[model samples]
Target: MKSPGIVIVGAGQSAAVAAHALREHGYRGHIAMLGREWHKPYERPPLSKAVLVAAQEPLLDVLAEEAWARSNIELLNGSDVAALDLAQQEVRLANGQTIEYEKCLVATGGEARTLLCCPPYRRRVHYIRTLDDARRLRAALQRRPQVAILGGGFLGLEIAHAALAVGASVTVLERATSLLDRFLPPEVSAWLQSNLCRAGARVLLGTSVSDAFPVETGRMLLATDAGARLEVDEVVVAIGLSPNDALARNAGLEIGPGGGVLVDANCRTSNEHVFACGDCASQQRPGQSQPTRLESWQNANEQARTAAAAMLGASPPKPPVPWFWTDQGAHNIQMLGLPADDLEYVRRGDPTNAKALWIGHRRLVPIHAVAINAGSELRALRPLFDRDQPVQLQDFHLDTLNLRAWAKQQALADAAVPR
Candidate 1:
């Protein structure tokens, strides 16, 4: 019997992983990937960090050109999927090309939400979602220009760090009272703010831009709502993201409240043959029925793997513990497992030194440690976050709770038989 042809839309991490996994599972069908960007599928995490520092490193391409060709996956770059005909199981591209597929994966990721308070920058402003955006932003930074970031979220802070690294003066304008208000608590956010300021970047909280207009010498005059004015060379917007669910909605597929395509645990959409993953799909948790969407790289990669397996009628692999990490200035913060708002928080280490663990539900749920070069330490504590056997706060000896010892204890405990 002939295998089924698989078409994956969106050439980000998720779509690329799905295409590779389908071929790896011995599927001898035609595999095609559609990407709107001119470049091949690549990782987004490095765009804000390493790529900002070095543009010629090819940070965006997640898969090598030679490897993709060897896998027999036809990559259609700079092609947009205009419409989806669910009834016919076909996708129409902007170039007037139609591809029939036995299975389709929609991984069209979200776009950065620009600030609406001021008029458009007209080629003067930039957003760092695509490789092109990063290239332009990097060029601006190379000029040793002054940068005014519009938001205090992760993206904004990451960009701020990169600009400062190149000796560029940065001023971050945040409407919120603190940075990273959505993810970190007040204390944690405050700690992050202090670190950014210490790194020579000025952070303005509870302030928003009233108007931004081009001025002399490639500079912009920003009128603040707080009766202040800022003159900067360029502006970078990192407010948030809005999902690209228009394609699914146009096809009459069910969408969630926050503009995400609704999908089941198996990553299947309302139409069984069409699947969605990454930042585009809104999926329910393992036990909870409430719809949720995660924009982290971990979620995107894991969901892609699951969607590919399900399409091939293979047993899905167990989902890894959801985790995310951020690199800002000289600190490396890693968050393992989920931290709920209602859950009680207990600080296990010193915040000033950038080494601490947050305990939730009286258990070692999320560990966020920061240091100059603590990548190894952060990776070590990841496996200790076992949902099945929750580690209580008392089980952690703050002084001696290194990564290796913690992992050994958790392994022994998990290995023991239960009554």
Candidate 2:
């Protein structure tokens, strides 16, 4: 019998990883990757950081042409999957084409959410969601312009960091009382706000843009709800994202309350043959009744691998601990495990020193150690999340042989040995 063919939608990291994993597992069937963007599957995390700083050449391409060709995966770039004919087991493309497949993976990611307070004001604002958006924003920053960011979330802060690095003045206006208010606690937000301000970016809290209009050359007039009018060169909106679940909804697939395609632990949608992952799919965690939809790169890659394994008739892969990292100015911030609002937080190191550990449910769930460059410390905390026992907090102190260092050393040694 011939191997079943698979069709993967959306040419981002998740879709690419899924296709790669399927082939690696000895799936000899035909594989096709459909992407809306003209470019092949590429990495996005660096678009805001390295790509912005690198010279003319684009740094977002995750898989080179040679690699894709060698993998024997067909790439359909600059094409959209309009509809899924579940009954016929086929996918309809935007260019009036259809492909038959035994199974399909929907990795369509979300689009940036723009504030709709006023239609006219929306035209003057820009959003950072794709490589093209980053390129445009990077060009604007090169002129050493004054930029206004809409939301004080991670995206806004990261953009601000990039802008500052390129010598552009920035003012971040957040409607919430604190930056990252939804994810990080109040204290952490305060620390982040201080760092942003110290880096020369103005941080505005509890403020909303009332109106925005283009003025003189490289200038814009912005009216705020706080009865303040400000002038800036450019405006970048980083409010949030809305999942791309319209196709799923049109196909009569189950969707979450927030419009995300609902999927089971195996990454299978309501229709068993149709699967979903990445930002668009809402899959519940082990013990949580509510579904979780993460917009991080880690979640996308891991979920794709899981979907690939399940599609190949392999047992479900173990879920990796959810980890997220953000680069702001010179500080490298990382969080491991899901932090709860009710959990007690203890500072292992001085926040002024930019190093600390967070204890949750009597377990050291989050290790936040930041310095001029602390990528090593961030990598050290990844395995601690998977440990069966709670990591002692006292070991985090630099002076004493700390628990974090000892635990990390042991982990490194264990990883070095062959299984």
Candidate 3:
């Protein structure tokens, strides 16, 4: 019998990972990857950091061309899957071409959330969601334009860091009173704000753009809700991302709470043969009450693998402990597990040092850990999360001894690993 083949949509991080995973699992069936972008899949994290500062293009492939060729996975770039015919088990592209598949993976990511702007301001304002967006913004940054980043999230702060490195005057305006309000705790948010301020970027809180009018050829006058007007050469909006679940929803698939395609523990969507992962898929954690759609690069890679395995009739993979990191001008914030506003903070290490760990605990158990410039420590302590037993604070001191060795002495490995 001929294999019905698998069709994966949206050539982003998740799609690329899924393609490689299916091949790695010894699936010899036909595989097709469809993308809306003309360029092949590349890393998105660099689009905000390295890509912005580099003088030349950086090769940002999740999976290299040679590997794809060896794997025999067809890359159909510039083909947007406009609609999915669920009954026929096929997808119709924007160009009116339809392709049949036994199973499909909807890895369509998202677009940057747009802000209201005045006439002539639309073209001048920038939004970074893709490599092309970053390329254009990078070109504009060369002029050392006074850039006003319209959001204070990680992406916006990362861009500000890049702009500051290039000698551009940077001003960040956020709608909320604090930066990264949705994810980071208030203390972390203040720390980030102070760092940006120290890096010579003006950080404003509780302010949002009401309108942006173009008074000159390249300059834009932005009027804020607080009745303040700031004129800048360029404006970049990094407010947030809206999930690209239109295709899934249009196909009568279940949509999750956060505008994501709802999926189960195995990353299987409403349509059994059809799966979803990455930023587009919403999944509920074991201990968590609500469904979550993680937008981090870690989630994208992990979820893709899960979706690929499930499609191959393998048992569901174990859920991963959520981990994400952000690189500012001089600070690298690496966090393990989810951060909650109500969680009590247990400060570890020298508080005076800029590089320190902020561990969050719920009563006795260590629920989350946020480390600054402590990636190694975070990775070492990751196994602790798999254990049901609480990681005691009395075990060792940050003042001396190896944290990794001490952690192992506690027999974290002996603890049952949760799925």
Candidate 4:
């Protein structure tokens, strides 16, 4: 096999995006994406929702087989990289094959965090991090068994809703005092808790599984810290993920405090020819004290483009505002900007009954915003965060709020002026 011009270490979303971006930017040389998974690259978002509920597997392919061939991109699935020979500028696979590269991108992403207590009871406990994991969990859910979801984050909640759709009773256990407390404001957190309750999910905040034992009916008995005993047929753990940075770390590349491969604004790692992106990358953006690792789809795609541009020695566009969305039953929650606990929140309309918008700001200058079932309006108000503009409280009122109309006028006004 010919040596690849750009060797991408992981064949996940970031790897697919980077390979395509390199081609788009006119880097005509050979490109290869190496992944540990047997399947082609696909998105991970639908694993908990669509994959769990639907009989037909969702077509979430990032780079289809035909597309890869058409783009002249080689996809080496089920190829595990043992170590990186930085000095030799080569990626060594576990099978003793070495692939030389002009540039290397480490997009290994992350692995799901598992509990030490549940490893012994693998048959009853499940964790979703890959397509195969989702398929296995989905088959388990088809039995409509009582499910206990550990953690109240996006993945856990989505799984709860999916289980409910399949006639399964779900109980969500979160260790925090409130659901999504780390990323959301207190009031918003309360609002989400209420929604979960209304959707038939029994949410237990500040509770965690203390011990688990097999019961007579072949179900697991869970003892909670709150001194409550619960029996469930299946347990799904959605705690979080640990970055897959062992390859970079073993190669002596710098790692960030968040346990990710450290990369600069251009996604360039310690070695100029080596780059990192996606969930595995801890990025040092412009004007930030500490490096942060964002585990979102948008971040993965954006960083892929940035790294591709850097590979070709071209100027990359500025990173967009951090954004993420989660679909929980009837509600679609979208959050903009980096999460900050210090921001004061201003509410618009009722969050439980009707759609609502929570603007989190410091001294009235918008820093972050959360839209509950109001994505388009949130997009209209997105430009506000880019500029240092102070928003008046009165503008958020349902009777007066017309951000879309206001944004349209601004667009028309800007278009009328001569360049």
Give the per-residue lDDT of model 4 (tens digit) for 1-419. Answer: 45769899999999998998898889999888899999888999889889988879889988776766667878899999999989999999999999999999999999989877676237878899999889888888889899999989988999998889888899999998889888888877888888778878899888988887778899988899879999999999999999999999999999998799999999999999999999999987533569989999999999999999999999987889889999888689999887676788887767756588888877666678898898887798677667645555555666575777764444334333222
Candidate 2, run of 10 with poorest lDDT: 364-373
Error of 4 at 241 (Å): 0.8
Worst 10 residues of 3 by lDDT: 410-419
lDDT of each: 0.79, 0.77, 0.84, 0.86
Q: Is candidate 1 or candidate 4 better by lDDT?
A: 4
TM-score per candidate, chains pooled: 0.90, 0.88, 0.94, 0.94
Q: How much does each candidate deviate from the true structure in C-alpha RMSD?
A: 3.4, 4.7, 2.9, 3.5
Off by over 4 Å in 1: 1-4, 55-59, 117-121, 216-218, 287-289, 362-384, 388-390, 395-397, 402-419
Q: Give the TM-score of candidate 2.
A: 0.88
* lDDT by residue for model 3 (1-419), tens: 12269999988999989989998899989988899999788899989888989777788998887886677877899998999889988999999989888999999998788876842137668998888888888988998999999999999999999999988999999999898866766667778898899899999899989989888566899999999999999999988888999999999999998789999999999999899999889988865677888999999999999999999998657878899999988788898888765677665564336666766766645668887777887788777666645555654445675788866754444433222
Q: Name the TM-score of candidate 1.
A: 0.90
| lDDT for predicted candidate 2 compared with the true structure | 0.77
Worst 10 residues of 4 by lDDT: 410-419
Residue 92 in model 2: lDDT: 89
Judge candidate 1 against the unseen true structure and give its global Cα lDDT, from 0 to 1.
Answer: 0.79
Candidate 2 Cα outliers beyond 4 Å, as residue runs: 1-4, 56-58, 64-66, 117-124, 216-218, 362-375, 378-384, 387-398, 405-419
Q: In model 3, where do residues sit more than 4 Å from their true spots?
A: 1-3, 118-121, 350-352, 394-397, 411-419
